[model samples]
Target chain A: MNFDLVAQLAISGLVIGSLYALLGVSFGLVYQTSKIFHLAGAIPFAAAGYAAVWAAKSLQLSIWLSIFIGLAAAVIIGVLILVLGYFPLIKKKATLLSLFLISLGLSVAFPNLLQIVFGVDNLPLEVYDAEGNPAVPFANPTYASGFLTITKLNIVQVVSSWLLVIAVLYTIKKTALGRSITALRTNPAMASAVGINNKVVYLVVFSVSSFLMGVAGILITLQFVANPTMGLQWTLIGFIAVFFGGITSLGGSALGGLILGLLSSLSGIWLGSQYAPIVTFAILFLTLLIRPQGLFGKEAI
Target chain B: MKTTNLILNASNINGGYGKHQVLRDVNINVGAGEIVGICGHNGAGKTTLLKSIFGIQPLTSGEVVFKDKDVTGFNTSKVTALGMSFTPSDRPLFRDLTIVENLQLGAHIVKDRSLIADRIAEVMEIFPILAERRNLLAGRLSGGQQRQLSLGMALMVQPSVMLLDEPSLGISPAVVEKTFEIIKDLAARKGMSVLLVEQNVRAMVKITDRVYVLRNGEIVLEESGDDSRKRTDWWQLF
Candidate 1:
């Protein structure tokens, strides 16, 4: 009931919400176009954070270089999942359930693989100094207004999230590739009939989606630390956001994530942080019951 | 027409979905500047034939020679690159996209921007209703207008061979006549070859230079459009 506490919570929610929005876009992009559940999208999401952390610690790389490598790693792994995993199944005319099962298997397997490689310890984003001692490379400055405090990184998270979402929406609206994606999503049979290569479009979708997931992972890693178990939780939250926002519209999914973030943050005022996910799922359930199409979605996808 | 002037020839085509055969040695051809019609009852492989020729449906065993090239077993994109376009019967246009966006997607393979612009302009000219609704979502258009936009999208490729499945599927009878006229005009003017499948036998027969009646998976009859119109025993063809 403290107003100052409420305002601070709201601000914190927006920051986390922005991250959720980015994740939603990442998950929604692949799901909307390919109708692949892509449960294994978690692999790329976690991979980005782990890769960035590894690059900084092991290679003594700069923050920017590590982030770039992280994004690149995410992209490569994401595309490989499609090429080596889904594409073969697709060629064999695998059902959506079958594809989801494969994705689920990979999702379960990759994190364990990461644990074996990185050990069962959380790795913070830090660069090793000349003496091989780890140190935070960048100064994430804080900016405060009124009763609320925010960081430069928080601002970056919010701005980059919106910018990337807008850029993706614009691409879907104006670019040739965007048109093809829209075509594939809306009318796939017509898309193929008009010479839109399914494989090429799927490749592009996976790359872009993976890139967004990497950014989300990197941003979260900067704030907290990278752990093998972190991917699926955030990814499930993103999936919830997409469903909450509506699966049909990407912008809707972004908005959904923001709302989810706000609600989860505000719920901390009355309930413990442990109940945030319960609140999130409750919203999803209510949304499904009240409006299955989602707040921004035109129809049920 | 002479076989030498054939622009599209699908000979010995045998194909189906899974193990169920939908096409059985279905041989069909289209001459340049000709509008050919394939009319039959539902489930008569009318759509499968067009899909087969355009490589949307995989042929079990066949050869599709387009423009003197053996395009057999080619995917839709490769076939489209070879100046062939297919427009499916149901929801041909990307319904969520604007008329202009759909046209742009129609020319998705074309790298030349100017050529795409020109094609869009030409398609708009051909279907003025689409021009008026250029900014509107294709799904918002009327059935007749949707048909026009679908045809315009197909024409965006400026294809040598266009395989249209059920042009008269959902449109009014009046629109069906207009659609046929437009098809005839396009074929005549652009020297484009059209092979359209339709269940609207009367409407299809009116515009076609040649008609092939498909029953089950085989061509039951092939006749000149003039002879097809003169016949009264259409029931026996199926």
Candidate 2:
């Protein structure tokens, strides 16, 4: 009923929505190419955060260097997961179900491994001076409008996420690689007939998807300290966003994330935040019941 | 005896999805600059023969010679890289991509980007309508235009041989007529060999230099295009 509250909720929703969109793109890209429900996406999502934290706290690096190392780790681990875990199965012509299970197992096991090594506590990488308060590169700088307050970090997160997603969409729209990805998504058999190497595409798709996931992990960690198991939650949200957006379409995923974010934010405002999960589930249920194809998706979710 | 003329010569190829063998010792060949047709009813292994040659469908036992090199067990992308292009019957072009983009994808095997552009230009010139609609998505085109784009995409590779499975699969009869003409023109003008699989035997036999009639899972009949055209009772071959 209150307009100011509504606007505030909307701003936060848009921010969260942008983050979800980035994550959704990450999840959707690999699925589109390989049709593997890459649950192990959670591995890089957590790994990148942990890597950044470790690089900062242990290796004594700058925030930028740490973030870079984290992203690099994400790409390598992402491809390594596919190569060691999925590629052999892929080569064997194992079914999507098999790949999904393998990814799911890795997803489950990796977080626990993180907990084992990193402990059950949150891994907040805070640099410090002699006083030991905190030495953060960029603090939560705010940008306020009439009765509406926003942070510089929020701006960075939203802008970077949307820009990256847009760049991917542009590449998909204008570039040769994008066309090949579409070709593979449409008819892989025809893709191979046209001389698009399946192995190479698979590697590229995994690496790109992983890089996006890694970036999400690092940025989120910087905002709110990384934990051992934070990835599982994001992966769950990311996967939900993918299906909600129409699994095949990148734009659909973004729109899906926005809608999901808006609904959750609205629920949090009016229904006391406790009902956010309920709202998301209700949307999921309704989508499954009514338009499983999603807003812009061409196929059934 | 003279294998040099054969751009693709796949012999004793036995394969299928699994358990059920669709292609049984299927021996087929496409001579240099020849248009070869394999005609059969649906599920009669016509498509399977093409798949085996392209190496998309792994053979239980076979010898595939492309440009007289043993390319058996090579992946489809490898086969494509070795101057062979295949336009499958179903959704050959990436419907979401523009005609030019589809053509660019068709020439994926070509390492040189400039050569790819030139090939795209050549393809567009061959199919002028595709040029007009180069920016348009292949999915938006009429069924005929989609077929043209699909063939043009394959032709962009400037392949020594192309394996086309039912270029007229889901188009109008008029489109089918035009498609066959284009295939004939491409083969003659480009000196490209084609091994085409079609359920539309009448149209296919007309343009093809030789016709191999497949039945069950084997080649039931082989005849010259001239002889095939003369025979009104071609159905008896199956």
Candidate 3:
């Protein structure tokens, strides 16, 4: 029993789990409210990473400013997809299946579009100096305590993800906006009768959801490198967390992500890291077979 | 039919699910402070007519005049903002929300916090049981209490016209009578016009000022509530 190895895996799991939690909440918010599959969320996630890289390289902006620009781009792109893609179809009385198909088409096409624009190479999130050399502006620093080691980016991932999640949870529980969202989610017909603009709420949720995805994308890019195809994979993990936790409860989704991360990491002790997804799928299969409603979900998805 | 101070009028309302028309040239009107009833059996387009007027269900062709303005094709939120509120038959209240939370959302369009609070207080006065169980989830309430809370939520907005799909649904005979009394009292007291659809013709006719009998997506007969009560052959109309 390698106790040191177990401790290291646990720390790594927590960091990755926090990122998954952020993504889970993002995906869960849109899915729970409108029941949209929202695969086009990948567009914004990839775009945010690319946008941050572009702002850093082309605009020569500070890392913070570039990050903000990336987040803004995510929000704008998300709103446009709803306004241009979903709203018109909704007006024509499109079915949920039709909308999900549209999202599927967009999700597939968007990465190809990014490939054409940004090429197949992964882009490092770094600023260029006078010598035309790429340099990381906010380079992640390593911190070690006893047998455990962590990076600055890892700490940021955990702190920022939980903060945003808490803010969203609070907003949903205590604010009028949250009440309006709850009304829409719980009973859409009554929501409209009470003068809640469903489309407006959709726009807000899309913006917020995209913003969360943007943050996740940037954090991942900082830890590694931005790639055109990264969004779909990360987002897939997010929805998996959502289903694992409970689609009906956001907090459940977040907790589900954390547990998933820990399990995926801890499994490395017995199986290879590559088999983590296999474990995840097995858990999902068992959940479907047994619980079906998820750990925190009161209703079946 | 002659109506005094007409608050809501739907003319030639035609609507339905895709390729399955439910409402056909249906026209109805309710006067200010009037309690109008639409009675029919299941699948007679009673709910369709109410939804069309309230703008939840889209009308293929119709002209809805509310407070003297042609509000054709207005969505539910717009219609609600124009002082019309609709409560559906199934899941009328947000079951997950507390009674107070549901009432607050009843006035979602109102930006004034104090006004919303005042409206909630007024609703509490009207439905005292709601005040007693103010913090309880709406889903936890008894069938009769849920109906009362639904009406109480509608009253939160102080709507000029309220469209209720079925008020007598899922409640006992004793509660049904009491619910009707509360509805009648609310309309008489607040001068709010109510257009409720019900299959419970006997119970509905008692509290209504006028009743329309719908069959096959069209109004088969229209009569004063008094005349409706005198007649015992409602099954023939349905």
Candidate 4:
């Protein structure tokens, strides 16, 4: 057996899986509370990546500062969409289909607009050291045991993802805000009667989801490179993870994401890297066929 | 009814779901510490009336005066913040949440955590079944127990007035009787006014101070609870 090849595939899968898990959790957070679908979350994902690159290169800031600027930009964009796009239609009691279409339109339009402004090239955000040197991502310390090797970035992704997932779960499961969100999710009309502000919860969900998206975007950019169209595929996968995991449970989404990541990686090893996307659809189709409610969903979608 | 001690007065409410026009200039009022009942057949605008008064449904024409202030078309949250809670007939409790979680959300307007805990304990004292299964998801409870939890949740806010769409929905007759009894005791003990809508006229009139018999989207008979109980031809209205 090819131990080195297997190890490489497994490590890569975990890194991507952690990213997918973060995105899935983010999508689930908003979708569960607001029931908005929020397909346009792609705009924030790719935009943040591009924004970080621009900030690092043009603004000449440290890598951490650029990422901060990028996240801030993503949050502002998200809030603007809520104010300009969603609130009016929600006031009029528009259907979910209408909201989906509005979001899809923006998702498609904004990323393409980014292409026009930033050009079609893939922008690689450079991390700088204190002496103004492009930091070597490879300089991350590595740990190896048996056939498996791990780097600082890999550990960071996995550890941080779990930490974030745990923190979010704790907040939603144990905190008052989380309880209110659950109430809003379950019965919105009754939530209002009980004095839970739907608009406030909606804003909170969007902001948190947007922040998660920004973090995922920058993380992926650090590993690979940022492009306007990078978000389209990620958005599709995020939805798949939500359904595959279960729409109602945040923990389920993270689990689904990791499972999807592993499956894709294994498929790449068995078949070719080109066949990885096929594995995603097949699993989703199977999950829908067997358990449309998803792994952790209380009710079928 | 006398205008002077009224806590809530919804006058001439005319509205519906986008031109359906379910409620037509209907007036309903609940006096302080009085348990007023709106008894009607299904689809007689009973739910719509409650929705309008609770600010769940927007009224095209009407004035909702609570505590002597005209709150015409305030949304549900604002109405809730101003001390009014409505319990719908269908799935009154958040089924996915635990019993205590549902009760905790009941006091969403209350900012103080300790105060909310006290309210939960107070409500649980009235409905011991909720205390028994406080950690269990509300959906897992039996139909009767779920209904009890729903009313217990409304009590968490300690509101001045509560609007309950129906009392006996999705519960057994035995449970319904118990629920009505609890309602009577709760009203007297808490000193909170209640605006209840129910299909069971006998059960409603028995516990209520006043009863409004609604038919075909209008109140056809308004009588004191004792008068309503004494009436021989009560079934003739339906």
Candidate 5:
């Protein structure tokens, strides 16, 4: 592979990896606390991207404002799931499998509902100039001592993704909320007995996770066109990242995302791009077979 | 004795886990400044009775009164808000939290931050070891220290009645003795009412003012500590 191509691919990989990490963190948070596999979490990512695009186009809102609206919508969706979808089952002490199925049903329903509203066409977010015209940057080539360089968007994605990962890590490590989350993960019954309202904690966690997922959706949309079906691919990548990292460890998930990103990128370059998914799935299957707990998972009680 | 009124009353209580009736029509009462010991075999309803009072386990059919107010069917937090605290036998301390954080959680119902701090200070005065290890993670503490922390957490709420389930379980003999001593001090000095459930009949009788022997979800024997000790034939129930 050429040096220019390698740099470009690596940067793209990092951006995708960062988005994956954010998604993994969201999935990990819910799984760690409630031990419920929230299949509906994927919906927020697709919904937010589409919502942002539609709002920006139809309402003539600023892109940033549209993003915020999308995030708010994601939070509402999260609360709906927590209250309407999960609460009743939880109140009844429903089995984990049943909760998983319910989440799956919501996951399927959310995207299909979006398709019905927005149609199945891929929606491109309009990046405009002062003249209200598409401002597609011309491809600038660099040939310096037998090497080429890519555009600035790749650089921005690389920097922003890493920054977000660091910020998330710092927040979870240093905050009171983080401590409470850790305590709940370790022993929820004890945490509740000590007066930490489990319900409140779960709600906060769900909202935060959904917000992060929504943010990831925006970032991913910036990188590629948004579609009603994009959430499933992102969700699959997120699940792999979460499992690779050790489902319970936030740090592990971030690391897993980076590793998976690098692997997928390298495989796409070396092998056929079609083999990338196969390679990723093979790695995941092997990880599961060899170490079912993932890289940083705690030993089973 | 201060002659304080009864703090907890349970009449005709029946409960069990999953169709197995562990506590059957059991009647028990604990007054302020009283330490009531509940002793029973492994399968007996001692822990079940405590669970029923704490609202952790649903009562099959019974009435639980706290401070002469009917608190039956109240959830755990509501029951806790009503001046009753439970320390489960499993030592349900928030293992990932520091000792101070765990204590803070105990006073979670207290909305005023100042009052919560004051309660923490008061609990520290009672358990100096906890105060010393305030910054350490609860799981890092020795079993004895955890037991003390659990008891301290229960005390943080300043509950009228403290329900302690097997405070001595899994602790060293030395720590077990110290735990019982603290139980005694709470009853004697603080005038705290305690319902202590334990399988260790000998240790429980040493600190409790009154003793109840539970068998097959029923209280078959009730006596003063001295009377129960002198008549040791109850040991056969186990």
Candidate 6:
């Protein structure tokens, strides 16, 4: 492994890792607050990605407006899940395992539904020049020292992910709503006695998590092409990152995302692309077997 | 005799987890400024009765009237909003949160932030140990302190009716004495109505104004606190 090749791998890993971190954080957020593993969370990401492109092209909207529209769509989907899925289950006092299976079923149902509506064809957004040819612009000039090239998108992803993480951490640590969430997690009965509405809190958590996941999906779409079938893969990667970080620990998930990204990149470099998924799954299986609680997860009662 | 205002009334309530039916048509009441002690053997439906009143458990048949309103089947949050607070037998505290945070959560229904803060401060004064350990995580507290914290949390809502289940279940004798003292003080000083459920009949009788001894999911005996205390056969109820 040459220095240039290692640097390239490192840079790409960090970019992909930040995306994973965003997805993983969304997963952790809903899981910690509501104890619901929303497998359908991934649909928001794929939906948002496809919606962003459709908004820009069909609706003739700007990039930023399209992103906002995508986010709003995600929020609406999330609220629907809470109203239609979570509320009924909780009201019925359904077991956690039952809720988990329901979420899994929803995950499968949502993307296929998307496929029916959007078609199974993969759509890549095109950037065209005056000549109607594919145009790739270097937004920020990269300083190439040997073989390592740094791009503006990489910087945006890394810097934005860090800023978002910091903001979320601050909110959780300093805000009254955050305190209520913590209270709910620790003792829900006591939280209610204290006057916190569990349903409202769960709604807030699910919406926020979904919004972040939507943003992550948009980012991934920008990097790759949007496909109806991409949700499952994104969900799998997010779950792995979440478990790697420790299911309950947000900070742990962020670190886990970065580590998984680095591992994937290194595997792709050394062992070839075909070995990447195997390595990721191998790590996930071993982690579950050795530390079912994840690296920082609390023991479940 | 003056008719005492009834704050909470549970009439012929039957409730349980699944079909077990721990509470079999139990009738209980708490009057304004009254401390009612409910003593029963394990699985005798004391906790179930309290839980049904607090909306933690659903009643199969019967009605729970609070302050002249039928509140049976209301969710726990709605019940709390109607000025009732419950501390369960297990003393469920937000273990990861600081004592102050835990107390703040107790007053979550209070929309006016400043009023909530004032209530929290007032509660801290009553449980000074909680104030002293305000920054400590609830999990680190002693069993007695945890119980006090749980009680304090219930009180933070400034509930007109407070439900406490086994406040001294796992605490030391000294802590139990202190707990009973606090219960007595809250009743006398604040005129708070309490439904105290306990397995320790003797200690419970000392602070309670009235006692209901339950056995096999039914009220087997009912006596004034003074009469219950003087009776030599009180141990037979347990």
Say which candidate scores most in lDDT.
1
DockQ of each: 0.88, 0.67, 0.75, 0.70, 0.42, 0.60
| Candidate closer to the true structure by TM-score (higher is better), 2 or 4 | 4
**Which regions of candidate 6 fall more than 4 Å away from where they truly are?**
A125-146, A298-301, B1-3, B18-20, B235-238
State the lDDT at B56 in candidate 1: 78
Error of 6 at A57 (Å): 2.5
| Backbone clash total, candidate 6 | 0
The candidate maximizing DockQ is 1
- On residues A1-301, what C-alpha lDDT tens digit does candidate 3 reach at each position? 9999999999999999998899999998999899888888888888899999999998988889999999999999999999999999988989999999999899898889989999999898997777778877545577888888888778888999999999998999999989988988999888887778899999999999999999998988888888878888888888888888989999998998899889899999999999998988888888778987788888778
Candidate 5 residue pairs in backbone clash: none
User: Considering only chain A, what is the TM-score of each predicted structure?
Assistant: 0.97, 0.96, 0.97, 0.94, 0.91, 0.93
Q: After superposition, how far is residue A23 of candidate 4 from its true place, in Å?
A: 1.0
Chain B TM-score, all predictions listed:
0.97, 0.96, 0.98, 0.96, 0.95, 0.96
Question: Of the pair 1 and 6, which is ahead by lDDT?
Answer: 1
lDDT of 1 by residue, B55-138 (tens): 878888989999989999888889998999998999989888889988999998899999999999989888888888899989
Write the residue-wise lDDT of candidate 3 on B75-173 in tens digits: 777777788888889889999999999998888877899999988998898888999999999999999999999898888778999899998899999
Residue lDDT tens for model 4, B54-153:
8778888989999888877787777777778889888888988999889988887888999989989888888888899989999999988988888888
Fnat for each predicted structure, in order: 0.90, 0.79, 0.81, 0.75, 0.31, 0.67
What is candidate 1's lDDT per residue for A1-301, written digit by digit as tens? 7998899989889999988999999899999899999988998889999999988987889889999999999999999999999999998899999999999999999989999999889899987767887766443577777788888888888999899999998998778998899889988999999999999999999999999999999988988899988899899999999989999999999999999999999999999889999999999999999999998987875
Q: lDDT of each structure?
A: 0.90, 0.85, 0.89, 0.85, 0.79, 0.82
What is the DockQ (computed on Cα atoms) for candidate 6?
0.60
| Clashes per candidate (backbone, < 3 Å) | 0, 0, 0, 0, 0, 0
Q: Give a tens-digit lDDT track for model 6, residues B171-193.
A: 99888988898988987887899
